[model samples]
Target: MNAQSAADPSAVNRFLKSVVAWSALFLVIVLLAGLVDPRYLDPQHKQFLFLLGFIGMWRYSNAFMHYCRGMYFLYWKYPRMRKQADKLGDQALPSEIYMVVTSFRIPSHTTYRVYRSVFEEAARVGVPVTVIVSIVERSDEVLIKDILRRHIPDGAQVKLVIVRARGTGKRDGLAHAFRALSRQMPADDAVVGVVDGDTKLLPGCVANAVKFFKLLPTVGGITTNEFCEVEGSELIRQWHALRFAQRHVNMCSMAVSKRVLTMTGRLSFFRSKILIDPLFISDVEADHLDHWRLGRFQFLTGDDKSSWFSLMRAGWDTFYAPDSNTLTVEHPPEKNFFKATRQLMFRWYGNSLRQNIRTTKLLGYERLGLFTSYVLYDQRVSMWTCLLGLTVSLVASIIYGAQYIIIYFLWVAISRTIMTLAYAFSGHSINPMYPLVLYYNQVAGSAMKVYALFNMNKQSWTRQKTTLDSGSGRFDAVLNQVSSKIMLFSSLCIFFGAVSVLIHLTQRAY
Candidate 1:
C-alpha cells in the first residue's frame, strides 16, 4: 500500500489563520491609505509623505533581504553543522564537564527545578560532572543537595561545591564560581556551562550542546536556544516567546558564519581553556571599557557582553546550537504592563547597543566574516532606522493632516502582522496581538537603545533592584551629561536633515 504523509492539522490551521490575518490587514491598509482626499495634500505635505514612503520601502526591502538570508542559513547550513556534530557526539569524549550555576534572590522552587534538571541531564551525558553553585543563602545549597539526593541516577558521578557570594551581582557570583572551576584544571577539551538560576535545563539540553566543542575545535563558547515561561500574564508570555523566536532566527543566521554576537548569560557552554585564561577571568570579573568621552568606566551591567567581547578579541569563534534548548523562567519587575515591558526593553537593548559599539570597531570583512560583521554594524543603525518611518509620519501629520498618521498606523499594523506570521515558522505560538507588541518592541526598544547609547554609564539590575555606583568627580560628571545630550541631539538632527533632503524639503543634507 502506498501511504503519504498527512499534513499536521495544527500547522494547516495556523497557515489558514495567517492567510486570513494578512488579508484583513491589507484591506485595512487600503481603506486607511485612501481615507483622505488627494485634494487636501499641499505641495509641502505631498513631498513629506513621499519621502516618508521612500523610507518605508527602503527599510522593508532591507529587512526582506536579511530575512531571506537568515532563512537560507537556518534551514540549509545549520543542518550541516548538526550532522557533523552528531558524528562527533557518537564518539567517546574523554573530557569531563563542568557547570557554574549562579542563584541570587531566586525562588526556592525555581532553584530546585534548575539543579534537578542540570543533574538529570548530567547523568544522561554519562560523564563526571562538577557543579559550582554560587549562592548567598545556605538554604539554596541545602535545596540543591536534596534534589541531587532524590534525582541523581545511580553511578552518576556528580560533585557539588558551594560558594557563597555577597549577593552584589551575577557578574561577581559568576566570576568567583568560574575562577573556582578554572583552578580545578580541567582538560583542554573539557566543556563548562554558565547557567542562570532562572534557566531550567530540558532533557538532552547539555548533552546536545557540549558535543560541539569537540566538533568545532575553533569554537570557544556556544549559547543554546531558549523558550521562556513567564511568571506573569499570558500577554507577557507571548511577548517573551516572540523575543526568543526572533533570537532563534538571528542566532541561526549568524551561526552560519561561525560567529554569533553575544554569549548569552542564560545558558552558555564554554571551553575550559577559555575560562582558565587569566585574561578571560579578568574580563568577566572586572572588565572596563575605554570610552572616548566617558574615559574608562567599569561595566555596571552586561556581564554577558563582556564575556562575548573577550571571546571576540581573543580570536575565538562563538556559535549558537539550535537543538540544545532550555527553559528560561522570566519574572517581570512589576505588574503594570507598560512599566514592566519598558524596563525590560531598556535593559535588553541597552546591553545590545553597548556591546554593538565595541563589537563594531572589530569589523572587518575577512576577520569577522562578511555577514556577521554586517549584522554588528546594522545593530548600530537599526535603532535609529526602526524609528525613522514613524517619526516622519508623525511630523507629517502635524505639518500636513491627521490622515497621514492614520495611514501610517494602518501600515504598521499590516506590516507587523505579516512579519509576525513569518515568525510562526520558528515553532512559537503566535498571537493576534503580537503585531501590536512587536511594534512596541521595535519603537520602544529602539528609543531605549538610543538613550542607553548616550547614558552608557548608568545601569540597573531589573530583578535585584541594585545599581552600580556611577558617582564620579562632579565636574567630569557634568561634562559627560552635557556631551551626551549634545551628541544625541546632533545625531537626531543629522538624521532628520538627511531625510528632509530626500523630498527636497531642506537644503542642509548636501
Candidate 2:
C-alpha cells in the first residue's frame, strides 16, 4: 500500500486508542482522589475542592494534549513520511549536499565513528558530497583526515575540507565552516547538513532528509530523530533515555504543524542558500537578546535556538524527521549524578528560555502559526505551574498532616507512569525508572528554568572547556544576581502566603 492509503486505517486506530488511554487516565485520577481523601471529590467544600481540582486538571490536560498530538504523528505523520521516503530510495537528486561536522576535543573513537558514518551515508546517496570537518585543535587534523580518507568509498564524489577555528565554541566552528562553504558557492538547490562531532548518522539519514527539500520548498531546515549511546550508571542511562523519549513526542507534535521549535544541532539539514546569507554566520555566532530586566546578554549556549530563530525570522519553516536517526555519544559532564544533571539542565534550559522570550517577541501568531505560538507561550506558563503544584502540596501537607505528602507522591507516581505508557505507543519501550526521572525533570527542571531565566547571560559549553560571560559590568552583574534571589524569595512567599490564607478560610468554614 502507498503512504496515504496506509495512514488512513492506522490513524483511526491510534485516535481510538488515544481516547481510551486518556479516559483511563482520568479514571485513575478520580480513584486516586478518593484514596487520598474522601472529601477531595465531595462537592460540599466547593471552594477548596475547586482549587484542588483546577490544579490537577490543568496538569493532566497538558499531558493529554501532548498525548493526542503525539498519537497523531505516530499514527499519521511519521508513517506517511517513512513510506514516502522509502519510495525515494537512494535516488540521487540534482543538488549537491555539503555535510559539516564540527569537533572540539571529542574523543578519538567518537570522531572516527562520526566521520565513518558521514562518508558511508554520502556514498550511499550517490551525489556529490562535500564534507567539511570543522575543528579547533590542529593536532587532531591528521587523525580526522586519516579517518575520512579511510572511510571514503572509491569513486564516490566526495571532497574533504577541514576548517580550523580559534577553539572558541561550536558556534564559532560552525561559523568558520559556513563561511568556507559559502566560498564554494554551492547551488541554491544544494543542502547543508550539520552534525555534531559526537553524533553518528544512521544509514539513509542523509538521503531521507535531503528528500524533504524536494518535497517542500518553503522548508528551511529539518532535524533528525536522535538516539544515544550513554556510558554511565543505570540511573544516568535511564535519565537520558527518558529525556529522548519525551523529546520524540514533543518533536513529533511540533512537526505536524511544521514549526519545530529548534532544529537540533546534533543533526540538522538546511537549504544551502540559507548559509550563504552574509549575516547568517554573525547571527548564529553572536545572537543575543535584550532582556528588560537582565539587560542585553549574548547567548552563551544554544546555537540550535539561534539557527532556528534565524530561519523563522527569514520566513522559513522548520521540520522534524522521525525516520531519520542519529546516535549521540553521551558522556556525563560530572561523575556525581546531581551535579552533572544540574549543570546540563542549566545550559539546556538557559538556551530554551532565552529563545522563548526572543522568539515570542519577534514572531508570534502571524509567523509561528497558532499551535507553535501557543506552545511558546505555554513554555513560560508551565514553569510556574509545575513549581506551584509542588509548593502548594508541600504547604498543605505541613498543615494537614504527612499523609498529604505521601498521597501526593503516590499521585505523581501513578500519573507519570500513565504518561510513560502513552509514550510507549509511539515506539518507546517502558522503562521502570521513567517515573522517578519524570518527577525529577518536572520539579528540578522547573527550578532550573527559574534560575536560567534570570541568569541567561551566564553560559558554559560544559563538554568543551569554554565559558561565555554575559558581559554585563560588575554593578549590573551583582544587580542581576540580587534580583534573581529576590524573585525566587518573592515567589515562594506568595505561594506559602496563599496557602496560609486558604487554610485559615477552611478553618472559618468549618
Most accurate candidate by lDDT:
2
Model 2 per-residue lDDT at 373 = 83
Q: lDDT tens digits, residues 1-510, model 1?
A: 112222666666766776786667667768876685665455645555566667678778767766676687767877887788787665725368998899988888788888888888877787888988899898888888899989986678888888989888888888889778877889877888999999999988887888777778788989989999999987788788888888887777677777888889899999888888888988888877678888877776788888988998888899888878899998889888778988888787777777777677754666687777777777778788888877766765676567767877877877897888888776666777678789988898888888888888777898889986756888988998899999999988898886565535622212
State the C-alpha lDDT per candidate. 0.80, 0.82
TM-score of each: 0.89, 0.89
**Model 2, TM vs. native:** 0.89
lDDT of 2 by residue, 1-510 (tens): 457755899877756765676667556656766567655436555665466658779878877887789789878877887677567665536469999989988888888888889888888887899999898887678987787678775688988898989988888889999999999999978999999989998998888778877777788999988888887887888788888888988888888888888989899999988987877788888888898888887776899999999999999998888878899999899888898899999899988989998998988889989888888888887777787666766776777666556567767878787777777887665565677789999989998987776667778988985887766689987998898878778876776787777667655554
Candidate 1 has a TM-score of: 0.89
lDDT of 2: 0.82
Q: Which consecutive 10 residues in model 2 have the weakest lDDT in total?
A: 40-49
